[model samples]
Target: MGKPKGRKVARHGGNPNAWREPKASSPSLSSVTTAEGLLEKLQSYMESCEFVVAEKFANRALERFPANSRVLEAAAECFTETGNITKARTCYLKAISVSPLKGWRKYLGLAQLLEGQNAVLQYTRGIEVMERELAEVAGPAQVETPNVPSASSSTEKDTAEIPTARDISNAYLSISELYTTDLCDDDNAEEMCKYALDKAMMADPKNPEAFQQMANFFLIKGDKEAAAQYVKGGLTLWYTDHLPPEQRISPENQQKVGVDYEEGSGMPGLALQIDTAKALIECAEYDLANRLFTEFITHSPTDPELWYLNGFSYFLHGNDYYPQARSALTKAKKFATTPHGICYDIIAQCDEHLESIAKVLPPTEDSDNEEEVVQTEDSVNRPEQSNCEDSDWETDEEGCEDVEM
Candidate 1:
């Protein structure tokens, strides 16, 4: 039979394009040549958690821009994140050598890589550089009349790379933490910590980390109320102050508020936010922690660690929150099991929590009602009810006789 005029003949029984191979897309890194371009590419890879690819690209960047301080610093950051501590140290050293007195960040980076006195010395150098740089920049303004506003101050606000008081404060905060951790055995550790913390707050009263560090210090001293107050102070800087009363009431609403703040401010990155959330959790601020975790989960739904943290926060809130804890833990276990084999540890922890919840909650009314219904049906069908009654009577009589004896 002849085909109809409007009918189209099938090519390979369906589509002609089906047999064609897909074209591979070129990598964006191919176009990058300048130091800035390479840094951006390196950062994009690092942010996406592509450490292997980031390492390869970082090495390529180093080969191309061997003496570029910015490139070296950025590559060092990538290496540090990927656990190549030795290479990261080398990169930081090279970066400092290339621009010794210009940037303070490389000193801080190298300091973080070292331990004990060496780390303290590096941190001190970085702090000195920061102070000197700030004073030099502010020198011209000090020379002018006290009432006059500096032209540079207005212009500097738009520059993201310029170190500010907050940076100096954060450096001091780092020193304070080191005293509490790596240098705790020193006779002057507590005094040094307090001094550093005081410097941090004085340098930048608005710096949230200063408040957080103070909270930690107070917590170490076993002053929970003071720690909580400081934690609240930290939260006020970037979180609570930005929200309306209505939005502050619930975690979901608070998460929305956080998202809006993040979009507008762009100051607190995910890591900082996570750190703040963890601080809240540690200070027994479960509501705030849960809200922050909700926002984090919205941004990175596949992050099992966040899910686990959320669950743990609820668990610590007490038995009343067990249901929410179970749900979050289950989600955490599910995500931890994917693309990799099931995480037996997560499974075990989740099972343990579930057992705890089971122990706390009474048996469901439905089960009890079902049992009663089944028993009633069995009694109706069985003609041996009298025999059961007789057994009960005999047991009661035996008990009575024993009591009398």
Candidate 2:
């Protein structure tokens, strides 16, 4: 009984509103068997490019293990990726409520979901979480490392995997950017920027963001020299791949920076800048390292550490950019956001380099008629007659490795 072939019927009028088939309902959480099974299935499905199936399992898993922090955390990441901001926020909240110390990740994700002052509060909360977690990790004022057999690989692994304050800085940097970018139209944003920058340094002194922001702090305050030095370590950079002669660590090159960044090579991240500088310095390529530091300072323009590293690189860079180093180190002293300690040591070293340079050089034209200058200043590692190897500068660098360049 088929309808007439070319029925001139008004389809819309015939059926004013079409009836739709009912959607299939998700499985009951109670019957999902176990959280482990759900998690495994979720992972397996995800790996097999079955995201719809994976999401279904994740939804069920959340229902069954509502208080499982891992499940909540995973949900937060998944929700975020899928643009489910509301669900992501809810999941992050549950995860954080259950484990505040481990909520830095969630805080960052949650911050992105909020706008204006609310986002700032979330970011602050994240910083606080990191502060508390770092304190907890440093529980014993000092850890007594007993001689353990190499066979105890598990113990070694435990030691290796333990989170440290430095480990938290990258997160702090990300949160701080929300303020700098003014995504939420922050009030007293500069202060907020500094707040996170301070914490970022406390978490990891060598953090590029912290260094860059600190430079910005100075720039915003109208101190261009300090700002420039903050990022560039106050040295005038010289581009070259070859190392200058060791004898060049004199007043003539005291303000010089040397580097060779590849053209069109995009700027490096904070960690990459630091690592590359460290490697260059270790290999006696002070000029190349100085160039890298300059790039960071040029790009970041707010990191106080870049200023310090700039100065440090100059000290060992064999360029004798001690004047710029002194200028940079002096400016760095203004911002004591952390107990990095190197600030003072570097200042002392700068004084030494300057004094040594003055003592060795023959009387200059300007000072020929002046009284013999009294050798009042203290000296650090003095240069050898004719040459001082940059290797000598590597001695005080060990402890700072954990902090920054």
Candidate 3:
């Protein structure tokens, strides 16, 4: 080789733990001439969370190559890690000054460090920086300089000046959340939300973030129709609409066909399905929830909590699923461990479900529901909304109102 690379020359004494050495005095600025050597040291310090050491390496690099925007960017990260946000802000500004047309990333970081009107201002500046950078990269006369690598060359995440659609979506979502959720400025928040949706649609026609934000925004404004429209726009439509009876699982007839999952049992697929089903129930997608619950119960039939939720969701869907609802509630009551009002509620629900079926069902269908009526009539004839000992309802699980109904 004509010349050796940036490897260290043999010192008088070499230690086995050279790479593992603790933070020490800064290297001489002239000694670390090449950006690669400085970057390697800085990256090592950063990976080890030695922010001060990383800053020292970056400063040394900057002293030799003042125009090295990447070194300045590295220094900014180190400053941020050391909790010196003001210094970090200065470093970012220097990075942008060094290469105005290639500093969108630094601008993005600078924006994150600000808040309120300042953050909005910074974000607006960052958008302009990114647009300018993209225009420069796409210009006809653009030239590649091999002498100095771009800051983005440090990693794939920082490689692009043109912001990805997801990136734009995230920026919009952040600003919207800041205005709507943090500041509680509904008017400005709504404007931001609309702009975000437009940006998201421009980025990708089917972006989920746009739909989710629209759904939440409309839901907050009490516009259910608009909420429903946006909810349907999302890629996942499982929670959007009602499922016909045929879509629900007949768990009683599912003859040990699937696997059962445990609560935090560490079984991967089962937990995922159960969690998905549980979320569906919360979103009032009882049809899909019922199917997931039934499938999970088939595998893990002994779970009293699952039984309870199955019964509860069916009850909410009305008397069409009354038989299954009553049966599940009765089963849940038997399996329940706590001798609390939850038991009473389940029993009461069973009674109400039976009464409802008696009205609409044929005379022969009345026998099963009426028979259950006499069995619990003497002991727990309290209505579904029990007037006695309301304290029992107070301690129940999620969605259980603490009021004495």
Which one wins on TM-score?
Answer: 1
CA error at residue 350 for candidate 3, angstroms? 19
- What is the Cα-based lDDT of residue 292 in candidate 2? 72
**Candidate 1, 1-405: lDDT as tens digits:** 111123343754865455443346424445577766777778888998988777777887888878777778888999999999999999998877766655688899999999877888888888887776677577945533224232222322233155788888888888888898899999999999999999999999988778888988988898878888888777766675346767474765565445444465635567766777777787888988898889889979976678778888888899988777867776765654432233345545655765676688554565345335534543454333223332312222122111100
Which has the greatest lDDT?
A: 1
Candidate structures ordered by TM-score, highest first: 1, 3, 2
Q: What TM-score does structure 2 among the candidates reach? A: 0.44
Off by over 4 Å in 2: 1-37, 40-53, 101-103, 140-163, 183-187, 216-222, 233-405
The residue-by-residue lDDT of candidate 2 on 50-161, one tens digit each, is 6665666667778777876666766776666666778889988887776564546677678778876677687778767666555657783554433433322242234323
- Give the deviation of candidate 3 from the true structure as CA RMSD: 12.7
RMSD of 2: 20.7
Per-candidate TM equals: 0.59, 0.44, 0.51
The pairs that clash in candidate 3 are 260-299
